[model samples]
Target: MSSAPSIPSAPSTHPAPPAGWQATFSEAVRLQSENRWEQALTLLLPLAEQMPHEASVQNLTAVLLAQHGRLAEAVVLWQRLLAADPGNVALVANLGRACWMLERKQQALEYFSLAVQLQPQDPLALLNMGAIHQGEGRFEEALAWYERVFAVDPHHVQALFNSAQLHADAGRFTRAHELYRRVLAIDSKHVIAQAQLIFTQHYLEHPSPAQLSALARRLGAQCAAQSPVFSNWLVSFEPERPLRIGLLSADLHDHPVGYFIEGLLAHSAGKEVTWIAYANNEKRTALTERIAPAFSAWNEVFRWSDDQLAARIRSDRIDILLDLSGMGSGHRLGVLARRPAPVQVNWLGYFGTTGLPGVQAVIADPRCVPEPEEHWFSERVWRLPSTRYCFTPPKNAPEVAELPALRQGALTFGCFQTLAKINPRVIAAWARIAQRAPQARWRIRCGVKSSEEDRRSLAQRLVQAGIAADRFKVEAPLERQRYLASYGEIDVALDTFPYPGGTTSAEALWMGVPTLTLSTPGMLGRQGEQIMGAAGMAENWICFDEDAYVDRAVALAQRSAWLALAEQRRAMREQVAGSALFDNARFSRDWHELVRNIWRDACEQVISRSSQGISGPKP
Candidate 1:
């Protein structure tokens, strides 16, 4: 009877449905579906208040908030919704994504793990976990997660592509190539996969001109058919306006890229170019501050959203956007894709193609991207006259005055590249060299901060090769200046195989330390050979099989006179200084010419469009 006591008759008008709440929510969902995140957020807030307990609505509201970048608020809402429906895999995944957007790595990992546990076959959760691991530099762990994603869903193109990148990073080019091929097989129009496959093929010393040409054709066809709108927004032409050249880099402080750019900055005094530095990497030091004054504006873009940073660049009307991070750590290729400036160029960072359609050109030397190899790149190759890349030694780098004398009793060999560069083959070769020169001590300087595990692993490798523990020395990471100074303690720097040192090799030469490198066919692997060739030490540039590389290293270590020649050491340093390696003026001139050419090409397109009364599609 009480139940039958008339469930109060539903209100006739329902109070006119609270002023556009449904309409607003529908509009919000429409905006969200269109990926117009900010507009969705603007409508979502009041709609969320009106439907607080609607699980789907709440979940979507949180996601919308996160998309608008209100991460903390989004997290709170997600937590509230998860509390009610704790087993909701989608909600958990969305929360995890928001956590990642906020850089709450551990929280993100936990939520994503929970989502995966709840739905073992969820590729999104697994993929997100892989991304988190990749961001943290745990590429192998990332690869495992990506493999799991692939196992659950073979059509997971992102997982396949990411696995390829992880394999490439680990120097497992064969596996990477297979993964890239899988991606291409799935979607022939997949530009990234196509570009990466071409790059990996070239990297593994398997150049395919046909593949490169096909890739170019695909890109050109897409550009033509879609009529992609390249931004024409120009920085005001101040004829006398000091060209505001913005250099965006994650390694602006004391990284190798920083070291190379320092020399250029040192030589840029009184130039018309006003440098704008965007330091995106951590570890700001006194050296970074010292370099800051050389720039007209120095910003830390990590604090800004992609749009905010893009807007800042547009507002500043940067004449040239020089990206020093080419698909490396903390690279801002996404921002570059927005076409932040009239001219964008990749220089001194990534050696290969960026595969970004927006990049106008890649700065390189004729030695690297020779005319015959022009088809290999998505962007035009701008060849520097002498060397596309240059090395700038620290101003206060100590002269190796008498340090060679200390090596009379024992020859110390050094390699300062990362442990990641020390592939199993590289270690094996080093072990062979160590065995040949019993009196020589092998010193490996890993660029990463020292860890007990790193030391133990390295020691195990050396011991496995039948070398005594006492024969090997592992030095901790050093400040840029201290690292340069540490080179003084070594007789010769042994370059790694299949992926040789770039900055480290140049640094060694600049510090009066000779580097002997074995040239590999891959462009990245032969960087040391190129640097040494430019430094006028091609005699020291050893191109041999693995066995011969070891033999050369041992021979160089055993010859005491060769190691102790003060005159020769001084001459090598002088040659490095005078050679194309340190000539900033020549680099600047080359850069200017390339920019002019790009401008001319762009201007011609604009002229053609104007004459035809044709406006290209918006990007």
Candidate 2:
């Protein structure tokens, strides 16, 4: 009776309440539009509960759940929506994205393919498909998808940029250059495209110091204007506390970035910094195991939803978040945008601006970010004294063999990089070198197995360059130890242009195979030049234009004695190993300084926030 008396009002039903469910839904939508996601969720949840049979409500709920980092719940809700409305392309696309976040790549691809089929002209669909293919290392397939996006929306910046990168990676300099130019045409101030163009031009023609400096100045100003300095942003910080530093990367395992990071971790072992690794890759390898112990905590973040990952980093009291996979495959730039850390830096893995607003600094060396050209980064340039990155060969690495002894009379010119690096222009240059030095036989080894498709593509390219497939020796993927040993068979390793081999060049040098590099303008394109300089092989660093690159290749190939001095170079390898190329201690000191600076700045920000009685947002 008391309960009945308390519930006696029940009067709103007669007045139909102040507003209907639709009005309440609209209010919730407005809250969502204002980015008050929690408020929106609170209001929508009740409405959704009342309208469980409504597909639109369910879809909206799913989206809200996704935004709130309730990915599993969102996925279930999305599945229910899709079951009710299987023909919804938007739902399919969203579901695909969720699946991708969940690391259910196959399911994501199937959904994406269906969405693409349904919305053939949809740029987003094409981009998503392209991304999936790119992640799978099916560059050609990714290129096709990106091309379709470009065909539909010619000014699609991402598609244009990514396609250009794909072309550059594939060694299609002409195509890559054209696409980069197209991007610039659309937005001349596009710093990345401008840098890439300069890089491409440098690959085509090694610019002199005057040219490099001029380009560097222009790039510096552009970068400075674009760089994100935290001073201008309204940043809130939590109280001073034990700082956690999270590093986000797709290359946490046996990649160039991994090689560079080894020394830094070992040096930081006793430091106050708490290092956390957020690996965004699915393929776990021995290198992963090797690197895991270096971190205070290692997380495979590829499976976490972006929001969830961001929340986790925030919860860890991370002060500085370093993005190592800047725009590279499996990058979490979206999460970075959420401002998971008080300060974020882009370093090591990417040389160019991330074009993201959240990153605070980009770690560079004086050589990479020369004083006059410090303006090209979107983040403030944090210059390391020696080098921004340092390479270290695995312990117990094999000894380099003399090429003269191994090659017999046939000179073997090798390029042990991904096939994608062997662009048409590179193939042509190598062919010209081969034509010049008839005794030289080319040996190409890519990390990818010599699949029939790869063989046909490469063979077609070589054939077009007037080189017979029979004259070329192609090898399949090799293990790290065996891969290093394979370089012993080479007289010299030919470095790629526009996107020169970084770790590959260092590894080649470690194996006593001198690498010949063509220095380009951008840091990304001239990495080989940098590595060679660091390795004390500046003479071997071929600073040449395209024509000169071929000429140099021919000249180096003709110097059979120098090329044959594998034993002498082996002595040099020891020197190179002792040099900055593999000097982990020196590199570690540089890294420590750079990170300490970042951490100090973050700590100051925390202090400032606390003084102002504005506690920093929880991670």
Q: Per-residue lDDT for 166 in model 1?
A: 78
What's the true lDDT of residue 58 in model 2? 70
Best by lDDT: 2
Instruction: Please provide, for model 1 over 379-429, each residue's C-alpha lDDT reduced to its tens digit, 9 standing for 90 to 100.
Output: 778776667677766678887654463546767788897665676777777
Score each candidate by Cα lDDT.
0.71, 0.72
- The C-alpha RMSD in Å for every predicted model, in order, reads 7.8, 9.4
Clashing pairs in 1: none
How many backbone clashes are present in model 1? 0
Off by over 4 Å in 2: 1-51, 64-73, 100-169, 173-254, 276-346, 352-385, 395-407, 418-432, 447-469, 474-482, 520-526, 536-564, 569-577, 594-619
